[model samples]
Target: MKGGILLLRSIAVISSSVATIISTMLPLFLYVSTPNIELISIFILLIFSAFLIHGVLTHALNDYTDHLSGTDTNSPAILSGGSRVIQTEVFSVESLGRFGKWLSILLVMILLVFLMLGYYRLAVLLFVGLWAAVAYSVPPLRFSYRPFIGEWLCTFPSVLFLGFAGAWLALGSPPEWALQNAVINALICIAWVMVHHIPDLDADKNAVPPKRTSVVWAAEKFGLAWSRLPALTYYFLAFTCTAWLIPERFWAGAGVTIVTAVSALFIFKMNVADPVQVSSYEKIMLMLAILNAVWLGIFI
Candidate 1:
């Protein structure tokens, strides 16, 4: 029982749920005004379905693939390594792979249910999540093994869709407010993830096949100091989005601006070689992101 619990928690399912749940719930709060039983039910289902695809399938596959590539084996970071289940011997590699495979089958079944029930948008969103997960870590098209391709092509779209999901489900089509929120959230998500990768730069480079994340690529091409470039570029982009929103939304925009500044500062202060400090900063940034998401929803 303890091992089972450990395995589940190690996957970071709850952590993954934070963005999607807030994204969905806030839109429901803003648009519905008073959510009916039907709305509540749909909300629950959407969140559950997203949990299946992202929290379960995506993390599971990523851990499995990273383990196979030996990245997790070499990782020194506290937070950015693949789930430490295989490293800790909580589960064997074969067992983790099977766990991911079964969860993927379950996700496909849920997708079919959405299609049959005329929830085409939900199906499409889930498919994006599924593709991002598989393509990110799987062979051949292993986007995460390359540089910018993984974050821009895989992580960005998946997170953007998740941000758009609540608004789409509530309003049929997302409003400008919702789209802007989604874009900001997606950009912030990318930013923090890049920070997460910073601590793993050396380990990623030394992986059997080389993880070659954006941070690693930047360090190799632009020099070690430039390793912070990928994450800073994204934080700047997220800040730019808030700047555009300030004219129409003073207080909310101001709130996000403060949070975004703090977030960027954490990255700026981060010692690229210090995994402990980077991990500490990563935790704070995550809290700030959740706060920013709530602030966005409240103003919406």
Candidate 2:
């Protein structure tokens, strides 16, 4: 039980669950017109399970990397120090590596089964998603160490692509409505990634190769200015996408948009007043994610 708890903490279970939920549900909500409720629920569960397993593998591998790199010392609460198992000596490095490798292989096999069931697009998408996960911290790419590329790759391929691919798999092909939702989803996803970095501002400064965005932004006023432009652009694109593609659900879409915009505004305002008070920003991100998923379900 103790070991199990360590594993769960290492994997950041709650965040991983939310990631799976967004990846699995957005696509279904957008593309599956007249969806069979029962079938959709099953697919969601399956996808969520797949993502959870992937997250576990990723967490293990990442922890191994951080241990090797000596970057896990004195990390922030939200920065995933990757020290849980390593610091506790619950698992040796060799054992953790073996676990990660086997877990990744198992995830691939499961994804292949989903593909054989006629979900061809999902199979292709899963490959890219897994690649991004590995590339984020692994050699030959280590893209996550880069600045802008890290942020966008983390946000787009992993989040946006998976969400879109899931929808395509469930619905065969996205309707204009689903496509519109995809745009909004992508924008929101980008924003979420940006805000997630705020919590890691300090640790990221000492990254070996040095992340450009983090360095530049940290020098600014509370890191708020760095994301302001992107955040505003995301909100604008979200509203425009919804307005153009979902005119029928205008009132609902507008309401959600307004709320999201306000939440963003509050985060910015609070950040400007006190950079230390960023818990509200995190809450706003969670709320936006939930509301975005709910709106897509209701409107699409």
Candidate 3:
């Protein structure tokens, strides 16, 4: 049980979120003539902690909701469905419900503190971010199941809000460069998120009433390899944008995106070889993009 709680603590993959925040925020850390190092440091600390807290809350809520729906019972998607802790009986739904609610309250309190600090816009954005996270799996408005809108709801707010938050705190506003990077990164996130759902396509399709992830829906409408076109398109666009915006870092960014593109070409091969191995494919693209961002920051 203790191990399970510990697992839950790390299960939402908070490191990736932190990494994204840092990657997008990297420009602020490096450029900007007269920077507030101390304030930027403080913002990083608070925002980092906020992401951790928010991860816990959202993941717990997701586990509880998925458990109720019996969705995770047979799901094998490592990155999609909720943590299997509840499905494994590691935690009770009641306990998870209590934990999620308490964490939500805690997050709200932190937001209130941010508001009191006069960070009005940041505070409002954080509030909206939290709502989107919770709404991803919560009832009635289960954004996780809402198709493309649901995908946007889950990905953009967290990525953009945090990206903008980091820039806003450091630069007083998200610069055109940061905003461009934010949009590019957001597209990659949504793309990889769709990739993440591919491994679970069969599981989702076989479910009662069927859980239609983007890949599942795509494959239904288009053929298998063809269904992956949109994700591939997003990846290429991100690569082009990175190169166009910062041609100096094209090699660094291109190295990763090219590898990602090659991997995508073979996705059908991998998916067939190991139906559940898509997490590696999804995560690699994300990690490389993150690395590309960091590399871009360093050279600039």
RMSD of each: 2.2, 4.3, 3.3
lDDT tens digits, residue span 175-224, model 1: 77778777888888888888889888888898878999999999999898
lDDT of 3 at 42: 48
lDDT winner, 1 or 3: 1
**For every model shown, what is its TM-score relative to the native structure?**
0.91, 0.75, 0.82
Assess the local accuracy of residue 204 in candidate 3 as a C-alpha lDDT between 0 and 100: 65
Residue 102 error for model 2, in Å?
3.2
Q: Which prediction has the highest lDDT against the true structure?
A: 1
Among the numbered candidates, top TM-score falls to 1
Off by over 4 Å in 1: 1-17
User: What range of 10 consecutive residues in model 2 has the weakest lDDT sum?
Assistant: 10-19
Q: What tens digits encode model 2's per-residue C-alpha lDDT throughout 1-300? A: 564456555223333334434544654545555466854675665466444544566567767766665455445544345537877788887888787778778869978897889767667666766776677767656665665565466545565554454456555664555555555666665555555555555555565644334323544544545545445455566666655744676755775577567757765575632334654565666666656755665565
User: Would you list the clashing residue pairs of candidate 1?
Assistant: none
Off by over 4 Å in 2: 1-46, 78-83, 87-94, 108-119, 212-240, 272-276
- In candidate 1, what residue range of length 10 has the lowest lDDT sum? 7-16
The candidate with the higher TM-score, 1 or 3, is: 1
